[model samples]
Target: MQPLDKSVYGPFQLYYDHALEMWCKDPANAGKQMSLHSVPQMVSYAFQKAFTPAKILPGFKSTGIYPMDRNIFPDHKFMPTYSADRPAPIPNRDEPASDSDSERRHTATTSPAPSKLDTFTSLKEIRPFPKAPARTEGPKKRKAVMSAILTSTPEKLSSQTVTISAAGPSKPKKLHYDADDDEGSQQCSGKTFGWNK
Candidate 1:
């Protein structure tokens, strides 16, 4: 393998590359490299070798390879064997029990008795809530406002003061009343005397 660049993550990069090679060589052993039991030791080794924190590794971040799980090796006991014909051990029924069992039994027995509510057939029905009293302020206040609006007088139009003068009296023609009145009165008397004679 080419020598890793001596950068901040150089050692971690080398270890990661070695781990990857090991993983590629045997995928089954990959679990062992990352198992819970071996991760701390593996991380310690990596730290001593000057590897950067595992979380910052390109492969670890991209592949989500946790340091702990990566180092953990699976226990062989947990694997299932199809050919092994081993029967599971049966539970023992004759084991001595404690007072809690007796209490549990008593509670179970008493709990099954029918309650008074079990025999009840009918329940009092709930009545709908009465509508809230109509708002008193609404109609009364509306009528008062309407009446006040109807009775009020419209505002008067504004007036302005203008200066005006009285017109001069018309001149009258002088009547010749003295001559006309004397002549008319004499003619009326003459006519009245002739009619009477």
Candidate 2:
């Protein structure tokens, strides 16, 4: 192994190196090196500057939880951030999770997370996720979102279906199939192709 060059990190490295070189050359302490505390502090002081805070975060003065001097990120940087309790599923709020589901979830949550040691060599080494079944008609078309101001009166449960509409509500529009209106617009006066009025 080769020794690191003191001036490798540009002018800042050279600047730090110059100070150390001066200290080492000082006749008062010719043999002694800087202490652990002093060395780390010196290194940090050389690199760490005033513009360290990450976020502006309106109304909040401090950028982070702790002060700049207080070492929030210690020597051992990253701690495992996996949650002990997994978050609830965001989908299907209308239907509550059953007891069986809760039990399954509990078992799933209790399973130990794949450790850092779990390494794979090839595609065949790892378990594969189930592939989705193929559909013949390609992808389905997206439906429009329903209007907010719609008021539905279920005449018959089968007849009354929520149609996705962008307009403010379903108005009582008279079916005009064959005749033309006063404004010369072809208003087709005929029955709508549905089960109800």
Candidate 3:
């Protein structure tokens, strides 16, 4: 066939070459795919194909399988089982009485010694130890002494008096003239010249 185009089929060519190489060297992988259980057989086939007595790398040899020892698989060892059946310990139930009970008993026994009447009698009997005598005379005695002094003085009269006299009667004087004088002339003169004229 004509040469394939390098620009279009370059990556496909490389993949096909690698698959052919794997198929040729691995006898256990008789075809393109193999199962997980056949990995040891495949590794054995690859070692024999890729390595020889003359072509072996330094410090390397064909051991016929991967990891060379069976202990490398963790599932090869044994594991112990666990249980959740054991129960927790329980607390104790019995205990003794406390000191508060004794204190309450003592208080209840000593609460009734003093009554109300006993307290009142004790207060009334608490007077002063010694007493003093009483006096008899006071302000009334002084008042009696003053009254006796005022009544003992004597009574005296005054010498001055006011007198009134009765009024006397007024008397008329008797007039006497010369017995020989002319009475008619005196009358006529008095009547005519003095009174009538």
Candidate 4:
């Protein structure tokens, strides 16, 4: 949907301005001569000119979803006024949430406006869509070569097994197996994202 004009949207104009400030600062936009410090109406102007729904929604040549995940207002940036059912913050790979995580929630009732600019940044509460389902799969992978070993054995039959694991970063694409005479030479290779990627 087309965003409403800055004058019509009330205080939320501050929120869009914060987004524009970020968009114009991206290095990819260098030399574009855009600035967050532009005229008051510029954010809505840019929103009309730039945030086409087609660019985010799926369609031909579409960039797919442009997620505006609710940001917790720790500083002077604009943020969505999320509901009490707000989704949990995704923990960073190496950073588990601390005990104070719950203490830091900046509810509209408790939100602070430390500067005059903060007044322009306040946004009305918005209902967000339900969060997507969580992924259930883990990262470990296993390959079995027992059948090949059984068939390629030389002379009298002998028990042989080959196990290859690619749990983390895989390099060199091809892994060679030096099978003994009974097992015969075997090669197995592939790339795995491990569970982390």
Candidate 5:
């Protein structure tokens, strides 16, 4: 059944909106702009015209509300409640129970509790993992080895002590090439290779 307001049934409203939109796009009303009052009337008329009693009558009959048939519900629905015509068979408390049922009931009552392994052990009771071994000084890198090699050979290097400035390494001078002067280039190229050459 349709709700009082379309917005109250959020999921149904989506399908309803789509159906309304398709109905509005008919060739008869190609470029029509619907007024607020006309829109609701159009929706109601469309729903009434589309969903006739023939389509809806089957739903009421299937639910068994119109004919008032109690048999439509499964056996489970009548399990809790009993009819007065047939009184429920009372168990004979005086008679001795069968061996199988007695054994089953005895085992059910005396079932073993959960094993110690299955039960939860607290973190506080469990022993903590052994502490990680202490970290020692690692071997020197390649740069350190190269520096040590250069400094160790005192005889190879000049005795003159080099002074390091706080300004860091000096920038190299840029060479200006003059195409007109071939002689200057030859001199410069010779010096680059070695003064002896």
Candidate 6:
């Protein structure tokens, strides 16, 4: 029998009705009409079978709810991404234009004549940045820096420097081997061979 409590029966009425329909329409029961007396029993049996605990256990495990493991979902689930690189759709060029739209197109195509500001030549006058002060100070400082770097010499380098170590100046090492040295000569002649003494 359907539960008398709306809280219990209200949510289940749709499922119960569906199961009753299936049961009543079964091929085995075809041509045999089910009386009102048999509907509640059939609906109750079908609903119980549909929601059995055995059938629902796997669902809970797949969703990682029973043991609460978050890694059950596969890595590829986070890999799909939206791409903005696709080619834009082709626009329809054969549209039937209305009077207003054609007027707008004509107006947009034939632009107004250039003003005095637009026709003015940029080369005639320098338009320095409004935020910058008179560039006189900057050029003077830059000129001084350039002159100092270009004219710098060893004397200038030594003026600001202090000698840490006065180890007498070192000479570059000379090459040990010359073209006159024989290729077959022993590098250490004092070490004699076993029988060559």
For candidate 1, write residues 114-171 as lDDT tens digits.
7667555444445555678876655434333323243334422111111112334547
| Each candidate: RMSD | 26.7, 31.3, 55.1, 33.8, 18.1, 31.9
**lDDT of the structure predicted as candidate 3:** 0.44
Model 2 / residue 81 / CA error / Å? 40
Evaluate model 2: give its lDDT. 0.51
| Residue-by-residue lDDT tens digits, candidate 5, 96-149 | 899998999999889977767977878756976678899997986655333334
Error of 1 at 42 (Å): 2.3
Q: On residues 121-150, what C-alpha lDDT tens digit does candidate 3 reach at each position? A: 554478755666787566554433322233
Q: What count of clashes does model 4 give?
A: 0
Candidate 4, after superposition: displacement of residue 85 in Å?
48
Off by over 4 Å in 6: 1-39, 78-197
Superposition error at 71 for model 5 (Å):
3.2
TM-scores for the candidates:
0.17, 0.19, 0.14, 0.15, 0.24, 0.24
Error of 1 at 84 (Å): 63
Clashes of each: 12, 7, 0, 0, 0, 0
Worst 10 residues of 6 by lDDT: 1-10
Across 1-197, the per-residue lDDT of candidate 6 in tens digits comes to: 11122233343566677777887678988888778888778668656755655555655665677677789778876654566456657888898889998999899889866665855557536775557666564434443332345346864665445352344466776544322233434333343223221
Over all chains combined, what TM-score does candidate 6 have?
A: 0.24
Runs off by more than 4 Å, candidate 3: 1-33, 57-197
Instruction: Specify the highest-lDDT model's number.
Output: 6
Which digits, one per residue and each the tens of the lDDT, describe model 4 over residues 147-179? 544455561244322122324445655575543
> Which pairs of residues collide in model 3?
none
- Candidate 3's TM-score reads 0.14
Q: Which candidate would rank higher by TM-score, 2 or 3? A: 2
